[model samples]
Target: MASPALPGREPGAGPRVEDLVQEVKRLRAEVEQLRVESAQLQRAVASHAVVDQAIGVLVMTAKINPEDGFMVLREISQHTNTKLSLIAEQIIKHAQDAALPETILAELHAALARRR
Candidate 1:
């Protein structure tokens, strides 16, 4: 038996129901992609903030210039096999406690001394 047409929709007028369903599916996929992109952007922004703060800490605590401070972070990130943002986050957290690990403290001092 044929299904009755919806009210205000003729049997063969406008888009078929399947077409509308496909369009809704396509829109949902697009929305999901946008959500994932938004999350990535948010993380990038947050990581940038942490890295900036860490650079400031290096400048003040290590007495290194901003350029050298960034270099120090990059060097540590490379040496430690860690992401730059993760290294920056660790530095900021340790700085907050005023108790950085001995090895990291030594490295920061060495980097600063080298810059002199």
Candidate 2:
């Protein structure tokens, strides 16, 4: 049996308006998801940079190699139950302001000593 075409659509015409609308909606959602992912990646990159800078500071101030510097930071983070990125930020701040909590300073000294 032959069927009649939709009201305004020809038998062989392209997709209906509803299908196009759904596709546009899907594309919009994908774009939003991509935007969120990009923001997360940007934050990760910035945090990584801060950690690297802190490692460099440790390398110079603690007179340790970069690898050892990272271990010292990890040790401090574990012992203090703090995030590694926050530890890194504090280290950088101390380098700039000559101010750091006594607990952190003690842990840093201990960690550096253990590496020697």
Candidate 3:
């Protein structure tokens, strides 16, 4: 396959070792960027999981809409002086374990919702 570089020339066609080193550095930068993006995606997924579970709990216990449930979580996080993502992770893990007690869920929801 032809690369965007010169047709006959290799990607790093230069004879100097510095060129090869530069290519390696460039590739390393790309790899690092990909790693950072992957980590961000993981955090996003975790946040979504927490929000989804909290919403479900709210809908079941408080008969609230999804928007209201999210707003409540945002509020609680703000009031508790904690990160929203952290709060979400706690809620998600508890819900996933299937051992979350009703009292705890209610308290957590209330705590998270008060921030906003």
Candidate 4:
């Protein structure tokens, strides 16, 4: 037997019941995809803020440009086999604390150079 027509659904509404249901589902999926993209954008913005502040610290204290600052941090991570996030956090914390010991900074540079 044929299924009964759903309420509020016109026969010529451009889609059958199954197609309408599928279209609704597709729209819902698109909305979810947009939500995920927005969330990712928010995260990227926050990460950018943190990294930017860290780079500013490097520029002010280490006398480097933004590009060089990021390059230096990446080089540090590669040389020490540490994650960039940790090093970025350290840079941010150092800026906040304003008491990053010079010895540690020196050691960090040396470590980045694979000298020790």
Candidate 5:
């Protein structure tokens, strides 16, 4: 007797079991990749927000334009061997208290004073 066809497949025409397993593996890998990509995107957005807040503080406190504000933040980040986002996060945290740490304030002033 002829074997019955698998559900939704013609007799002898559907993917083999191994092929289905491989397809499931491929789909799982894709889902994992998407998860990693999503996490990276979320971190990037959070970092961008901190950086923007730092820029705003620079603009308000240093009387600098937004472009120069970002430049100053970048320069300070470079000088301190810190990530720009970290520097920005620190700035935002301190600014909420209406003061920055003395060293950071000094570095910020110097960075702003320098020509890019």
Candidate 6:
């Protein structure tokens, strides 16, 4: 079959300007998607660092290992219907300032006690 012809161009000449424009648009969209994914991955990395610090605090305070510390945080987060990262942040702040919500403290104590 004959290829579609552009105004002043032969049927099988190199790619048309429209094709180049479409490819550029597609690349731009892909780049935007990659940027969003990169930002999300960065945030995840930061959250992971915070959680690790919080786990260190728990390990020291409860005389438990890192694995047990993570379990304690997970238990409190699950019981409180909170995000693990948020729970970890609160724990880190409490370590620094000695201030924490009573509900969270109670759940934390219960979780630690169960582990013992």
Best candidate (score: TM-score): 6
Residue 109, model 2: Cα distance from true site in angstroms: 1.3
| Tens digit per residue, CA lDDT, model 1, 76-113 | 77766779898788789878885766666666667667
TM-score of candidate 1 on Cα atoms, chains taken together: 0.79
What's the true lDDT of residue 40 in model 5? 100
How would you encode candidate 5's per-residue C-alpha lDDT over 1-116 as one tens digit per residue?
99899888889896788999999999999999999999999999999998999999888977889999999899888888889998898888878775766777788879877834
How high is the CA lDDT of each candidate model? 0.84, 0.92, 0.69, 0.72, 0.87, 0.94
lDDT of 3 at 1: 75
Candidate 6, after superposition: displacement of residue 13 in Å?
2.1
Q: What lDDT does candidate 4 reach at residue 98? A: 52
Q: What would you estimate as the lDDT of candidate 3?
A: 0.69
lDDT value, residue 40 of candidate 4: 96
lDDT digits (tens) for residues 1-116 of candidate 2:
65578879787577867899999999999999999999999999999999999999999988899999999999999999999999999999999986888888999999988988
- Candidate 6, RMSD to the unseen true structure: 3.8
Ranking by lDDT: 6, 2, 5, 1, 4, 3
Superposed by TM-score, candidate 5 places the C-alpha of residue 55 at a distance from the truth, in angstroms, of: 0.4
Query: What are the per-residue Cα lDDT tens digits for candidate 3 across 8-50?
Result: 7778574667887999999999999999999999988877887
User: Where does model 2 exceed 4 Å of error?
Assistant: 1-9
Per-residue CA lDDT of candidate 4, range 27-68, in tens?
999999999999999988887787777778777877767787
Question: What lDDT score is found at residue 46 in candidate 5?
Answer: 92
Over the full model, what C-alpha lDDT does candidate 2 score relative to the true structure?
A: 0.92
Give the distance in Å from residue 104's predicted Cα in candidate 4 to where it truly belongs. Answer: 8.8
Overall local distance difference test of candidate 1:
0.84
TM-score-best of 2 and 4: 2
